[model samples]
Target: MEIRLFQLLVPGVALLFIAAVAVRYLKGKINLSEFLLSLIFWMGLGVFAIFPDNISVFVAKLFGIKDNVNAVLFLSIGVIVYLLFKLYAEIKENRRKLTLLTRKIALKDAEELDEL
Candidate 1:
């Protein structure tokens, strides 16, 4: 078995970072869903970093990609795009809620002023 520096280095750093995030989640700095999703993502990253060939080859075969690296690249881009859309939706919802709350407050203030 070949011991590659990258395989060790990447996993080691990722594990440490994941641990820190887990602690923050426990302390209530982050939500449960976010923590769980991040944990799963980091663990998968560690596994793939250690055995990239396995995942790349599997993906390439499944997707009919000519190269394993291309398979990995394509999958990564897809994940990023999905995450971006999710974030956009969350931001839009938050903006809508904020607008509703501001309107309610303004109406209340106007009513109070009329009473005065």
Candidate 2:
């Protein structure tokens, strides 16, 4: 089997990220679920990079895609959309919390001024 530069480089980078995530989890910076999810993602990335053609072909068949390239593209876009949705939801929640906190502070300040 022929080894490509990207096959080596991608796995190396994935390993680094996996180690970082493990360290973070050990330090209590991330929960078990986050660590496991990150571990799975990085391992899958490394495996995919190492055997791109084989994995892509499998994915294509599984998704009933005619072409492997198209299958990869479709999967990538789906993941990106999901992440975007999650980010948007988090941002909306943060905005709502901030608005409530601001109103509470404003009411407290107004009450203090009325006393003065």
Candidate 3:
């Protein structure tokens, strides 16, 4: 199949997502493994980005994987799962902090009442 503009978009999307994750983690001050894994991911994305669709199809066949579209789709699922877990953990931590703060405020209020 001829590589059309629409086909090129598959790799572009992957690269964009990789960029977002990289920026987010960097801003969060995460180190080492995260950066390395992101670098590897960006490499795969770069393969798809720098080369045409035919190259990906050839490599995918050699690797016993699916076509470029399916490969991108599958890769996206992993990103989605990671984001979901990250969001869940963030929400849980925020809730814990909120609860702790609420308890502290209530205790302080109770102390003030006792003093009055």
Best by the lDDT measure: 2
Give the whole-model CA lDDT for all candidates, comma-separated: 0.92, 0.95, 0.74
Candidate 1 residues lying further than 4 Å off, grouped into runs, are none
Error of 2 at 48 (Å): 0.6
Candidate 3: list runs displaced more than 4 Å.
1-48, 52-63
Q: How much does candidate 2 score in TM-score? A: 0.86
- Taking all chains together, each candidate's TM-score versus the true structure is 0.79, 0.86, 0.54
List model 2 lDDT by residue over 1-116, tens digit each. 89999999999999999999999999999999989988998999999999999999999999899999999999899878977997899899999999999999999999989943
Worst 10 residues of 1 by lDDT: 107-116
lDDT of the structure predicted as candidate 2: 0.95
TM-score of predicted structure 3? 0.54
Candidate achieving the largest TM-score: 2
Ranking by lDDT: 2, 1, 3
- Tens-place lDDT per residue, model 3, 77-108, is 87889879978999999999999999999999
